[model samples]
Target: MAKGHRSQIARLRNENKDTRPSAKVSYARVSVTKACFVLDAIRGKDVTTALGILAYNNRYASSVIYKLLKSAVANAENNNGLKADDLYVAECFANKGPTMKRIHPRAQGRAYRIEKRTSHITVVLDEKK
Candidate 1:
């Protein structure tokens, strides 16, 4: 249990919040492994180079992450008042989200469970010091 009132807890939580600009896509219809392949490419790269990598990559997750990266860059510029040129991907990851289960009928009327996995992808951007 928390040791503070509701308002106090809210204020304390807000104080420790991450200040770097970022963007997240919840319930993205891509698996964590696939998304990590894209995230690994741009983890520490500058925004322009990261975008370039995403632009040419042929992976499906790259497309989703491409738009997400752009949104993060825009967030840094508009919300954080930071220059896009100075920003790099500080942290980018995909966490597991809810899995949608589907039934796949097999031989002898056997039903197999097919899981359609989803992920929550996040891209955090920070200015180079």
Candidate 2:
């Protein structure tokens, strides 16, 4: 096999063997910009702290993301046999989703275009070292 192929195989072999499971929420009603605000707050926070932050957040998107976080935590516990206290926000991000276009009635028989936004959110938990 080529050197590049050998390296790729080795990389995969060295990856974490833990069975930690993650959950994703796609096409959420929240916008990417709004979701990013919540993600930033919990990027490096511990599981407990992150939950606290989400609980107190007044933003609309926080509710949705908090539910996703809980789901991921449950996945890690039930699927991977990991403890909630040992998990952290390893990776969390929101990407822009498809825009739904609609027309609004306007004066002079003209229509105004409106774009409703959506977001794709993902949460990944890892076992703390």
Candidate 3:
């Protein structure tokens, strides 16, 4: 209510706002679109259920994502001092990263350009509030 106390309230709000742990895997050799396919299936789901979804996914990105998700859940439990069962995959997504350019040999003394795509994937989990 007082001027000096307003800053304290703000700090408390920030501390209480989703202090769960997260993990990020950057420069993954996968495109954002491909990663999103797997992320879209697990977003807003419990940790166990999200892992289940990742396990059965046929996409190649799922393997990497599954490990990242597990890391996030572990972080929540160990670092953030939160229970794994109380957390869920609040957010998961991938963004395009740097592209590697290469030249491929072609017929008639020509060259073909190759763009190797990369992505930065992040998984954020939070306790159900």
Candidate 4:
């Protein structure tokens, strides 16, 4: 039983064994749905091409994602010793974060709940094989 538990722990630790460099932006002031729109455009694209798309995109989320992508590329080059020219976006995603709640005053002493959504974004880059 002890041997089985130890093996399971080892496997769990190795689950994220990928050497690709990644960057994350937590609690960004953007909704997950909005961020996903930008993330979808960059996935599987070369670093240069992805930057081009992000640079020209008009969405507000694109601006935030653009910075995050650049950080990931820099991480790959400096930390992972990978070439920026050969890097591609292996994965990009945005997850929902805690929402800030506020009350809006309405007519007749009524109050309306307002939610400001936030997201956590991650970008992973890998070298072309």
Root-mean-square deviation per candidate: 1.4, 3.5, 4.5, 2.3
Clashes of each: 0, 0, 0, 0
**In model 1, which regions exceed 4 Å deviation?**
1-6
Q: What are the per-residue Cα lDDT tens digits for candidate 4 across 1-129?
A: 235688797897799688789999999999999999889999999999999999999999999999999999889888989889999999999999999999999999999999999999999998899
Candidate 2 TM-score to native: 0.84
Model 3 residue 81 lDDT score: 88
On residues 1-129, what C-alpha lDDT tens digit does candidate 3 reach at each position?
Answer: 435588888987788786658999999999899999999999999999999999998899999999999999888878878988898988888989999999999999999999989999999998898
lDDT of 2 by residue, 53-119 (tens): 9999999999998999999999988888889998899889998999999999999999999989999
Q: Output the number of the TM-score-best candidate.
A: 1
Against the true structure, candidate 2 has what lDDT?
0.89
TM-score of 1: 0.92
Q: Which stretches of candidate 4 lie over 4 Å from their true place?
A: 1-16
* Alpha-carbon deviation at 116 in model 3, angstroms: 1.0
Q: Is candidate 3 or candidate 4 better by lDDT?
A: 4
Lowest lDDT block of 10, candidate 2: 12-21
Clashing pairs in 2: none
Q: Using lDDT as the measure, what is the rank order of every candidate, best first?
A: 1, 4, 3, 2
Error of 4 at 49 (Å): 0.6
